[model samples]
Target: MTHQTTPTMLDTDVLIVGAGPVGMALALDLRYRGIRFSILDASDGTVVHPKVGTVGPRSMELFRRWGVAGRIRDAGWPGDHPLDIAWVTAVGGHEIHRLPFGTTDTRPPLPYTPEPEQVCPQHWLSPLLAREVGVHPEGPLRRECRVDGFRQDPDGVTAWATDLRTRERMTVRARYLVACDGASSSLRKAAGIPAPSRHATRVFRNILFRAPQLRRQLGARGALVHFLTQPPALRFPLRSMDGRELYRLTVAASGHAGNRDLDEDALAMVRAAIAFDTPLQIVSENVWYLTHRVARRFRSGRVLLAGDAAHTLSPSGGFGMNTGICDAADLGWKLAADLAGWAGPGLLDSYDTERRPVAERSLEEANVNLMRTMARELPKEILLNSEDGARARAELAKELERGGVRGEFEAPDVHFGFRYASDLVVGDGDSDSDSDGDGDGDWRTDAVPGGRAPHAWLDEGTSTLDLFGQGFRLLSFTDEPAAPPTALAALTTAFADRRVPLGTTRCHDASVAALYGKPHVLVRPDGHVAWRGTQLPADPGRLADTVRGAR
Candidate 1:
């Protein structure tokens, strides 16, 4: 007699552990690349509470590429509503410094990227992204499915998961495995990856509530976020979760300086934060820890970590989720290339070399924003309605301006300015790219190698950003009557011979050419400039090798 074992198989090239925004974003990107994947979530496919408030511009650009930006943009957030961030004693209380960010409809068109920021919270965003990747049991996304464990060999990863509802066992064989299992990622732990804390971890309580009349009361005075400048552990953002009745108030659950505070009721906390006597109902509350931890490495063998699994940061600037989404975008293309048998020996290695540094930078920057709110002096009298109160408000406004608080609300460089410096990226002259924010602008656009290719409107309804993503794009600039150099014309054959999908776009616009800083620029599938030069290289295969991480 023989005991036979049958393993439930998945028709998947990549196995994704977790169906959070980061995992879903990776799925969406992989779907865009026409790759086969299976994404599993332990919990049901319902976003009961949302944490992330706003999606950054760069994330929007990637979402635009994935074909869900329109759905996100039109996902019921009022276009005429104010996008401002206001500091107040409460929602209807004394107004202090208000950063007058005009309504999305009224704000002047930005010169940088096509898609700007949107106020779509995670609860709404999660379903939208999940649907984009498909949610059926037979489809890529599997709701109520939990990945218990996985083992990665040199050739592939074998993940063991179970259907939570049925108590059924399953096996997923894949070329690669991505762990988006969140901050306390068990897979990351099982893989023995170290993500040491970069800053002191603090606990916070998010109180989700519905103030039905709060929107009416805050009508003209309504801002996206109301920073309650209360003293001690109470100072945090009371945000408009849905731009409507729904709102969330964040409070420090942990006592000041690590003291324990019992009897910290959620209702009492909400009342203390909101000065207005508006009708508000407590929906639910979730307590979470804000830790700054970046993994030493994003990849271990055939398994990779994305999102909170790779790095966890303070959400003061809303960079945590956006950073994770960008990680998915970066990894998706490389994973696709590897699966399609076109990836170079070192292509996948560049994922950590590029994204890990960005995570560290975002972590440090988010901490700065957190400290700005934490270390702020509340002056108990800022809430008073008297002359002393007015003076206190006026003084505090000046201090905030001098403190560079605007960096938290308007950080474009944090999103668009990171440059990949690895063996794959061919630097023209200097390794440094446009990373510093130039005062008013969140990011300065420059076409230096290793940076995001600068955006330009080639024609109405067409952007230069649309030129990349599918494959390696060569922006072969031709000076009107003069044709492309013979070497430039021959580059396509070299790339094709190596099975690298390379496309050429001849640009006559000198302004567009000037923004790129080089006559010919190679844009990677992730929309970053891989190489740039005055003319085509003598050996185009070497250029391909350099960009593809073969060399």
Candidate 2:
């Protein structure tokens, strides 16, 4: 577990800490932009628990940009395992509500995005990305390295790190330091940024184990995620990780009372969730506190926070890692712009203004999902006797009907519906109107203002998401100007001349044109629309400066 260590001074445009999905993702973006950067992680390059089970549609779209989406799709998750979200009294117990989203093969083609979410968990995903990024001896990825401290200058940052194996200290000087570290980020705390909780915190434990016969034992009852509802012991998900022997069971830590050793008792808790008797081997156990929190700020001098470092939310809606991936993408381009010297002055600061609100919204939505589960009152009759078992079943069904349990599992809105309300976004003066022309000021569900440009199928094999992978894309209709106004083209050329990695494309499709609500739409490198206008702006230099953060 040790590697040869030679004294060295490493220099790069950016130094990224934490090699989780978000850190690796930021590395991928920086690589594509041709930005010189290094990534460091404390652990030797291996993933455990894989807390993240599914890649959200938006995150998958970004992966497609990185040229790894196809590999992720081909990852070993069973093609036929049910992708549906099912709620029940137990794994084999009474089924209450089911959102039957078809498996990867059975689902109909989506018009908007080619990369409809896949079931690849983190353990499978992390290695594939690491391989593509190339962890050579002097490559940007430095495994088994831990960042201990960093100091920032007006122009750059000097970071000190330790080799976990050799215990040798080293220094890295870079223009910027990005902390993609997890929620309990030592770096964020070291930088003196406080992440105050927005709501009460709750603790839970995840148990990863192998159950070879569990899937077959359950037979037709096998599901991607099974929520256990029994009280006092298990009340969380028993999910199938990759449909093999691997599985994850989440249980409330509070149920353990004060017991420190989690052995047979923990196994028995998992056993109670399923109706079938199958052999199981416990792999690893992790106890984590779920908090709804957003850091007071995301940036400090030359050091910036991304991913779990910036915000942490309940996993009820599965937005934890996806939010971080989006953060990497947003910060990737802005950092590249700044490094390349074409970025506007305020570009980096906008990262906080635009992303903080989205994190707040995600926190609120996830808390709502958690409340739905926490508020359920287990009926006394259900726990009472065999004599009133039939009456208990009736009461359970009634409660399920009123409980709206499906929100816990099927939250497409949280995954894809967030919009940015930043100073850079240009509105058509109708940003508050709904689809029906009602000015309700309800922006969450409404697709106006800064919402993600809708998805549409452009061809038999391609989707609108496919068009935006490599760089900044400008999707315009044929009726609009054949080329962007001269000013816009000048800005594009300026960034391109400096090797900033931006691209512009025009889409003549009638459907995409309508979805974007403007003739010319400028999408950022991360696929979020940065600027949109009914007609090309008169001064392309000003627009470019605005988009590139020059203004």
Candidate 3:
């Protein structure tokens, strides 16, 4: 007689390792595309000491697509809080320079995007996304589930994980696996991907505390961030985390160049940064190493890396998490296409080709911000009340202005100006789509191939961006008494024959047509322009195949 044992098994179209914001963003996108996937995380989905403070505008737009942007906007941050960035000697001390960004309620409407950036810390954001991804027992997200290892074969990937609470063994099989396991990703190591450091690592400390009465005491003088210019000890940012009582103060862990003060007192630093005595409680202290690392490759066999796993940059400009979210958006639709059996041989490969460059560029930009902050000179005289102190403060302010410190806070191009260049994207004449920023100030209107499609208002409350989400979209611009070109019929038939999901929209607005700079535009599911021209190609099937990564 032989005894047989049963195996606990799970199967999905895609298996996601890690449930941080980046991983959850991917889940949101996959859910939007009606795909089956599972997210595994070791933690219980609680963010105690949040690292990310503000979501960038591009990430907010993607969150809008995922149907949670409104929820994030309503997640307890006050609407009337000042959105300014101030360089001060300390809180309630001498104001060196101030970049005034009006409050959310008073800021002028931006013409480029419908959704602006929002201040949603990870603690508030994680729970909202977890609920959206479904946290039930039968749901796609499995918290307290740690994946130990995985193996890939010709058919799919098989992962072994253990429920941390029960210590029970389980197996997960999927066609593809994505590792959003963060900067110290073990799966990335297991896959033999090398993420070499691009800059020397430095350790910094964050002190999270609740100063209940601090906001009331400051009154109209409050700002979103107070960049401390204190000499030798406190030269980092003391930020308002929740626009409420919670705040975080960052400092160099080593004090000075050779101080070696690893056991520095946390409360002492906090008090030194605050000029007035107030009721406060220390919540937690975190010491994190800042490293600049980008993986040599984002994919290895069937396993892919995203978020901090693919690239880890300084948080000086808040680009780390936002870049990872964009990575998820780019990969989400491609994975769906592959699962639906419509992906070309080169479609999945374009994820690496398109996103790796963006990561490198963002890493460089973030590092520049970091170096600027690190190189700032905080003379001891800047803290005095004498005329020399005032002179020092004025000189530093002038230097900051000359260095363009405001770009770190007010860079819309950093958020929305990256263009993808790959085999899947069809470029027009002399179109160098690899540029990272808006060179000619036309990023908001130019529908350049391999870039995000331009946004225009179709009506009072609707934007042209609202037209494309679930699949490919074809926009036809026709003036009055002029019908859509005859070539549209051929394009629609060609896409239909290949079973590709394509939506067609005909617009008669001359202004919108002029903004697009073309009579016909094809937008990908991720909202990037695939191709735009005055007339469709004679071989519509070839155009469809080219955009689908088949040609």
RMSD list, candidates in order? 2.6, 3.9, 2.2
Candidate 3 positional error at 278, Å: 0.9
Measured by lDDT, the strongest candidate is 3
Error of 2 at 299 (Å): 0.5
- Per candidate, the number of residue pairs that clash is 1, 8, 0
TM-scores, one per candidate: 0.95, 0.90, 0.96
* Alpha-carbon local distance difference test for all models: 0.85, 0.76, 0.88
What does candidate 2's lDDT look like per residue over 80-195, in tens digits?
A: 78877665566766654556777788889654456778888989988888887878484678889989888888889998998888888889999999998889999899899999
Candidate 3: where is the Cα deviation over 4 Å?
A: 1-7, 255-260, 430-438, 480-485
Candidate 1 structure quality by residue, lDDT tens digits, 1-551 = 99665757885788898998899999989989999888888888777778988889999999988888899998889888889989888777888889999998999978898999999998888888877787775477888888888877878988888888877888888888999999999999999999998888887878899988887877888999888888776678889888879999888776443345524777888888777687879998777778899999999989999999999999978899999999999999999998888889899999999999899989999999999888898898787889999999999989989998888999888888777778888767743543322223212546776778888999998899999889999886757443455686678878987889998898988888777777788999999888888878889989888887799
The candidates, ranked best first by lDDT, are 3, 1, 2
Point out the higher-scoring one by TM-score: 1 or 3: 3
lDDT for position 243 in model 2: 83
Q: Residue 291 lDDT in model 2? A: 78
lDDT of 3: 0.88
TM value for model 1: 0.95
Judged by lDDT against the true structure, how good is candidate 2? 0.76
| Poorly placed runs, candidate 1 (over 4 Å) | 1-7, 255-262, 430-443, 480-485
